[model samples]
Target chain A: MKYYNWGIIGLGEIATSFTNSFQQENSQITAVASRTLSKAVAFANEHDIPKAYGSFEALLADQAIDIVYIAVPNRQHIEHILKALAAGKHVLCEKAITMNSAELTQAMTLAEEKGLILAEAMTIFNMPLYQELRSQIDSNRFGKLKMIQAPFGSYKEPDPSNRFFNPDLAGGALLDIGTYAVSFARWFFTSQPKVIASVMQPFSTGVDEQSATILQNDVQEMATVSLSFQAKMPKQGVVAFEDAYIVINEYPRADEAKIFFNDGTVETIVSGDSTQALNYEITNMIKMIEGETSNRSLFLTKDVIDLLDQMQQNWTN
Target chain B: MKYYNWGIIGLGEIATSFTNSFQQENSQITAVASRTLSKAVAFANEHDIPKAYGSFEALLADQAIDIVYIAVPNRQHIEHILKALAAGKHVLCEKAITMNSAELTQAMTLAEEKGLILAEAMTIFNMPLYQELRSQIDSNRFGKLKMIQAPFGSYKEPDPSNRFFNPDLAGGALLDIGTYAVSFARWFFTSQPKVIASVMQPFSTGVDEQSATILQNDVQEMATVSLSFQAKMPKQGVVAFEDAYIVINEYPRADEAKIFFNDGTVETIVSGDSTQALNYEITNMIKMIEGETSNRSLFLTKDVIDLLDQMQQNWTN
Candidate 1:
């Protein structure tokens, strides 16, 4: 019956939202950090946290902090994760957890060596509705999983220097938004899937602005992940099966899904709250910290990173 | 304008639906032919048709029949088309018009030499709702078109003897139902598109049971078409643009569509009637016969057949 104290670094919009969950039960966000002392002080004051640090190292080095939540840019995740793990803190990094599988494997190895928990703040991995839906599928009513369609498209202004299209920031649609779609697909897959065919359209800065990919596994389960930055598409994730198909629109933190059965019937399933998305991630992370369960979602995160790796390789060649 | 005297060859289920359009103002379905004389007579008597033929050649030789609608299976389309065209009849053949581009090309050349009209009875080509939407795009208020997704999946019982999986019947999801999806994508495209990536899974009878394909044209318009016979997917056709996206559910013969704008506005567009889908085909064919308009949709049908050709080629290699 212990509440976990969290320390957040990289004071961006997402980090600000993460701190907003401090009032949730079983949560204590005690520390905040930024490179600028004034910015860190202002954020800590706004969130009413007890401590603020001018640098990430100072916060990570704090003895009272149990979890270090990294909200740094995609390019900076690996360094922050390694540094936090080295400073004896369990790390919960933002999505696109690492640039590639190699970096993630290195971080996972270090976390295991240090006997600390490591996980991604991917909403799909933590959403409770998906858990209930998965159990429904396991009950043999929905039948076998057959196909998946996960499309994430956002219309960003055509600015080359923005993080979305910038190469120096590890920017592209895949890392910034495609991660959610890929993770959504990987969650339902029985085994690791391989990218069989893919194509990409690059932006003015030579990064993936949009792409379409097809994936298949040993069990013949297929998925299509379509992503775009120059256009807007609904965050609708569909997992189609034998007897029924489930539709989860705005799926990153969706709390409701509609199951459409072949006999012309629909059942509504609701679980958890969309407002408590970050809180759920925190509570789940705390459970992993308590040795109640493991960070099993890392398997899906690793598979998603590998899939992204293959999607971008299509443009290089 | 003359209501062309129509003769139907191959009195199948689809042919029955075609004759049901006799009540339309511009339809004159006068004759029908079947391999069995009894079936032909039965169909003719049921539809109040004046003539019934024991064989396809007899129907083609009847000078009173100016237009012949070929409602045969996919494998038999080319033969019926070439024979009907040689008899100086304008031919309207069922979809998957020919097995491949070569067969269609041969039929097209003979029709041109004989000064006859040849078209495919693809509902997308004749659906009035799509025509209105295309004009909306051309008006530039909707902005530049960006992406399209045309998914059609139908759950047919897994009877290998049925046409959906029988190789002898030219059965497969792609040829049967996938044609509607591919043709839907081709309708709004600016030019011919090439298949960029494709993957297929065959049923037990070695026919394509399901597949996913990506296509891109010279104008950079991209589309994803997913088809499966083992699953039931709404025939939702999405045409995304910079300003708004139009969604046509049951798009094969859709009569209405919803336009979702980036500014959180939904506009419903209703153009044609769903019940008059077959009648629209006959009317459009009559327009082509009168030389008042060209069978311009044939261009889309041709491109769709070519795309399907490339899609199935993935399995052979």
Candidate 2:
């Protein structure tokens, strides 16, 4: 079997992006599977993959497929994650990883029991700019880490049948976009933070269309996160300090940040290319599987899922 | 007496900014006052004023003063406002117009009873661009108002004895910078919105150092306001709609906005001068006193204060 052997279990838009990104530097797409044989064959032919399977189980049974990239819809994450892990293949699923902490814990436990790797394909956990900023923060280059603001908004049509507002699809701003905002926040806080307060405006389908949440870490460093589905807000992230602040515009895939100091000097910091965001996630997943790095990003992802769970729980009242 | 005679009840930095701003167009400053006679006399000489008062009482007794601009500290706003209104002069008090809604209501009622005009020096209610934006919204220019964001932050030293953290002076982020943030949000909302959620970080002196509040209007339009006293946040405000959104940088004194449409068209809107933000407040106050404009700004100020009161009350619990 070739090193870094990979198979895709879904042929959606996200799956195409993943296949293209992973193939940019290395070609290890051993096979691809879709519910329909024609669709899988078409995708595999277009991507020049070695094989295509009509059933996910057939691809999982392939001895050459050591890892499975689960690109299915949100509602199918846990089932696919467990199936791939139980089939002795490492799993890297798209965000959000699961519906709640319970589901995530079950999957995590199964992966641990099987001695297999499992991670959420949250770009926030893999972005090189965040990793660079995290080290700068730890090095005390700026003063105390005090405040962070993460705002993400994407305009989606109000049609109730649309996937953005469809309740059966686990559709809402929270799972769709709030995961990134919360993950960005969780990565900055010193420790796990609690959801101090949360409020949401629900769509006609009883899903959160827009929401605001406040989080405070044990050290009193607070974070404010705002999300919306009907408006386009700038994806600006601010990490403020006592004597300076770091601002990253279009922060989700940002490779640059401007640091404004109280002493009237501004410094700009740059990291890896933003266009390679997906490739960065794939590279990091490979490193974790190869035992080259610790699974800290997975821990942060777990905390973020917990935060999303609590925020949703809060809205139920 | 001049048609628009004005007297200032404080000799602080804000009072100086007010003097400079009001003089840019027309010179109507009739007198100046300070508790110290020498300070008052120096201020009068520097500004070329006709009279100076050693005490606030002496300024209220000046028959030539038809209006009073109270620029005292936050804790002293109510006292000077009441004194100015009771002396039969129209009052324009610095924001955080009063300690609480009760105090503001008392002053508002007294002003109504005494037939004197009273208004807060909140530039948000008087800025021409906001008025222009409001009319545009009324004209259905941008499908529907969905979200508004107002964030303000000003860093101060962590000294507990400093006025920014002193409880005796009613010094806090809420009264100081939050007034601007909240006022910006309140001006855009269709109706009075309740504080759905609030969280704050207190300073060593027990005054709020930073805070976040979520508000939802009657039409389900949502707003997010964040404030800080120990960090500098961009005073950028966002007014988002269904198909387009307006962004104003340095929004507290903004005279321009950039409208971004979904179809990739960008339009710039400009009105008035930012340098004359305080002058706009002065001009609008004069218009209200002259029976040309209604006391709508004052009503907005009252609503903003009520929201601030509720946020503070939440912190105590």
Highest TM-score, which number?
1
DockQ of each: 0.67, 0.71
Cα displacement (Å) at residue A135, model 2: 0.7
Candidate 2 chain B least-lDDT 10 residues:
B18-27
Clashing pairs in 2: none
The sequence of per-residue lDDT tens digits that candidate 1 reaches over residues A239-279 is 88878888998999899999999999999999989888888
Query: After best superposition, candidate 2 residue A32: deviation in angstroms?
Result: 0.2
lDDT of 2 by residue, B232-260 (tens): 87788988888898899998898899999
**What are the runs in model 1 whose C-alpha is more than 4 Å off?**
none
| Model 1 CAPRI rating | medium
TM-score of every candidate relative to the true structure: 0.98, 0.98
lDDT of 2 by residue, A6-60 (tens): 9999899999988878733443888999999999999999999989999999999
- Per-residue lDDT of B174-235 in model 1, one digit per residue for the tens? 98998898999999888888998888878999988888888888877888888888887767
